[model samples]
Target chain A: MSDTARDRILERLRNAPRQEAPRPDAPASTAADPDRGARVGRLKSLLEAMRTEVHVLPAAEWIPRLREVLQARAIKTLLYAPETGLGAALAEARQQDAAGLPELVAYSETVESFKERIFAVDAAVTTAAGAVADTGALILRPTRAEPRLMSLVPPVHIAVLAAEAIHPSLSEAMQDGRWSADMPTNLLLISGPSKTADIELTLAFGVHGPKELIVFILDD
Target chain B: MANEPFENNVDRALADAQLRKNFAFAMGNFILKRRAVFSDAEQTERLRTIGHAIKQRALSRLPELLEQLEAACTRNGIRVHWAETTAVGNRIVLEIIESHAAARVVKGKSMVSEEMHLNAFLANHGIEAIETDLGEFIIQLNGETPSHIIVPAIHKNKAQIAQIFHEKVAGAPYTEEVAELNAIARNTLRRKFYEAGIGLSGVNFAVAETGTLCLVENEGNGRMCTTVPPVHIAVMGLEKVVERLEDLPPLLRLLTGSATGQLVTTYVNLITSPRREGEKDGPQEVHLVILDNGRSRIYQDPQLRQTLQCVRCGTCLNHCPVYTRIGGHAYGFVYPGPIGKILTPQVEGLEKAGTLAFASSLCGACEEVCPVKIPIPALLRRLRDESYSSAPESSVPGRGCKQNWAERLAWKGWAFLNTHPRLNRLTTALLGLVGDYLPPAGPLERWMRYRSEPKFAPRSLHRRIREEGIADE
Candidate 1:
């Protein structure tokens, strides 16, 4: 940074209107409450209104339910993460099934390799840390291991979000301590399937992103 | 590339029944969704006030704000470059790519890059530029310009896309199913993401306090474009600067609500600098090119300066009745609709684009939805006046002759009418007769013929009052 540029930025900051100072002593572990559940329920309703299919399951049963849904939807290959619970479930299900229902692929590998695996598959399923109840959105933090292309390249995107992740607003999500440090540098908040109404304002689905989005809400 | 005139583009769009239907359905739905989202006029008014005030504050202290952003970004290890002209901006980007000896560049949707024709410039030097935005990618493959601000391929349908994909994505079979088509593109672009050495993106807003470049998108391509590649370059118009991070919330609310009727887009990635130490994935080096182009010139004109505040939400295009009928390409520029009418002339030069200023019906819809409250209609009128005055008088063959003829005729008519009221009445009666006989010839005659003549009020009001014994005061 040049001294001139640095000085310019400092000057602008000095001129800006001051805001109420942020409270620095807030607790990191804010208690989870029953209100979180109600928010999730309302979010589920919004998803329903948009014609998206939603399912809630216990953490233990989540993997089986996801496998069933993916199989039923004819999903063949998927992008996943071990840190997210859904990744563990899919792994367990794949091991138990002698007949490979769908291949579980990780995004950290070579792009050419991932493409080859995804090209044969029907859809991609990833895990979401949370969902914004107000907007029926899922938040996914993609890191080096979880390549960003997984979410966009697939036709149908299945996001597995824990019920505990539901937040009333994006501000609350940002305030969460988990996001402040080692924040997976890239966070994606998906609302619905990728769509465009650009051609003569005509609504067209599957333009740039996933055409269909399915969210699995886990209770455990 | 088609070399068709802008009028022909409008004609082509107007003739397409399916496209018209599609635009009607989409824009109608968007308008209704916006109304629902902003149902509380009072709340909207409050938001508008905050939005306008914040932008004004930022603009008022632009130099300082830009400096603060540059400092913060530098501390975070992001390289920031400033260019006073479009040529300089393009050159900076080209030099950056050249330093890396990069050949293939993949880009996220950046209107500024399009305005500068960065892709063509890079291609001229044997560098291949690919658009990662689906709509932009489709248009690029077709060798055409973006027709819509948000949806670049808005004029193309699925069948057309399927055909384009078949021809472009080597060995891919043609399929009309939306999913199958999407899969093909996904497969094709997956390799591009990894192979491309440089990723180019557009900055939606640059925070001066944090030196953060904010990118909002639905697809994850923006993240890929900014992160997956080793080198990331962001090109932004100089006016995109904001004073602080706190001002973002309201502007984001307004932009998402107005642009897509979403509470927020799927992704609002704020990159403070290049990937920090211990970070898993992001560009190794991040460069920001601030392009002034013709913006500084626009800032010189007080009334037109407000146009710099545009966030490019594209609500103006979405709500424009004329744009809905003719799509975006008709404007013959990257921007379209009411905002385009005012901006194109100023940015591209009025000498070449003066006619676009007169395209608006001046319905004031653009001003109503503008988050920053740019009075677009008034600016357009001002441009029109400027264009008219600046036009070479000698070029107009009969300019003085026409004015002299009109002046002579008006004085003669005024003298004749003032000297003989009866003759004037006779002439008026003759006009009425002639108007009736004309059979209502287009707009001019129709306007007069449709109105009732008032029957000369049966009798003068003065005469009636006198007969009734009322005193005329």
Candidate 2:
């Protein structure tokens, strides 16, 4: 990234509206809904039906569980976060895995560094604030740590979503447009694996985005 | 250039029994499936109404809608550019690549890009633009324009494609097996996806409310082209806008069902902006280039404005008997069909492509199947009228002129006979006398070719009625 481009991005970020914290007194509408349990159950069943494995955990336990999954799979996993502790946890994981274990990578807020990390890793795991129950979509506010290509180019994708973040419909998701202002230049609503039927209407998987998607649900 | 006339291409295609068989089979299945899907007349009418209303709403408030869309997209970090012409559209895309200092650009199937000939333009500027859509990729490798709008290489056979792949890709063995050939293309294009610095796509619709660009494709290449590359640029015509996200479903249903007889395309990507935080896999930088390209000029003409409502389902071509016989190449435009017959002349100018208007049989099949209900036959007639008026008198064949002369004389003689009963009787008797004197088949046969000779009545109406005493009564 050129200095000018970096400066421009910084300036844009500085001028961007600060994200409003969730109302503390507000009811846990998403989590408390009677349908939330059913939705998650259905999502798990659907994923299982598609031959994908699902994992459930608390948010506090996600980082460790993901590291374990990546190690078991023997594939390089890159974690993207702007928070300092998240980076520290990833680094600690790498140090623990020094004896020829799976590589654990972490990206920060710098676009160039983020780009470098994305190209190096085979799978990407990121956190989404919400997931749409209707279409099995995960919504994330991507930043430098989660470069657009990271989610796409990798063969496998794991998106961790907080239980309270799930939305019932896209319309409800759109109602929270303020959260979208900080959105990257592109917002993709990916339902399932990347697939194509271009050649003689034959379905082929993994043309662009991850062919396999694993959603990790976490109770906040 | 191939040094082959359009007719020669048609002849070659006609001779290819396999290609004809494949095309006929596909077209027949598509027609049957689409008919079944849209069996309910009332539902189809409602869908058409909704689609037309949405398109009309977008067109009426285009400037306002575009600004709203731009604002929403920009807030989400997507860059929006406007192009006034094809050259500008191509230039804007090339500039996006140059800014990234990209050496290679991988593109998904985009008809607008093809219309702009952006690949060649980019190649001239020393940037490689590889098409990623299988049909488009095959045609691109062959260095030919798309024969059909939906199926670019519809005129080609499997063997022909295998030969092209073998000749183009070094060390690649020829294979008639579909799966092996697909694997070869996949392996070749997979590298391009990873290496290309930029991706280019075409927009199916741009939602003004959310500033989202929707792309519907059966192939995952569209997803790859838009997501794998760091930077993504989408070029769309100005007419491809709809007012709200709610309007998408109906249009999508109609487009999918009418185009390929699918319940829905395998993939429907709705990109609001670029990549956001904590997201994996999407373009970091997204640029949208909206093109006008004489659309506003067409908008000014009420007779032709309905063409803007076309969703490009290609049903018109499939049902067009003439198009099925001659195929798409003879029309000589990016769009080839009944819609092309009207649109090409308007966009490229009537003087340049006037004869295409005369290609139709005016059977009204295209108008019947058109999803948006564009009055194609009426438009064709208007184009023909324009062609005739503007065409030079010397350009018309002498045989046509002779037929016109005979028709005019026959009408004049009928008018003269109507004014005088005695003259009518005399003319009737003269016709009988001439018929008796003429040889069975000689010069009269040549005259018959120019004008049909009416069979002589046995007796005049007045004489027969008088003999029957009906006149006295």
Number of the top-ranking candidate, with DockQ as the measure: 1
Which regions in candidate 1 have their CA more than 4 angstroms from the true location? A1-34, A47-53, A58-64, A67-129, A142-164, A175-184, A193-214, A218-220, B1-26, B166-169, B172-176, B388-473
- Model 1 lDDT per residue over A152-205, tens place: 667787877889889876656766634433344455667777654433444455
Off by over 4 Å in 2: A1-122, A125-147, A158-184, A213-220, B1-9, B32-44, B67-80, B99-101, B176-180, B218-220, B227-230, B261-267, B271-285, B318-326, B361-371, B389-473
Candidate 1 scores an iRMS of 6.6
Scoring the B chain of model 2 against the true B chain gives a TM-score of 0.82
Model 1, CA-based lDDT = 0.72
CA lDDT of B153 in candidate 2?
Answer: 77
CAPRI category for model 1: incorrect
Which 10-residue window in model 1 chain B sums to the lowest lDDT?
B393-402
- Residue B288: error of model 1 in Å? 1.5
DockQ of each: 0.17, 0.14
TM-score of each: 0.76, 0.71
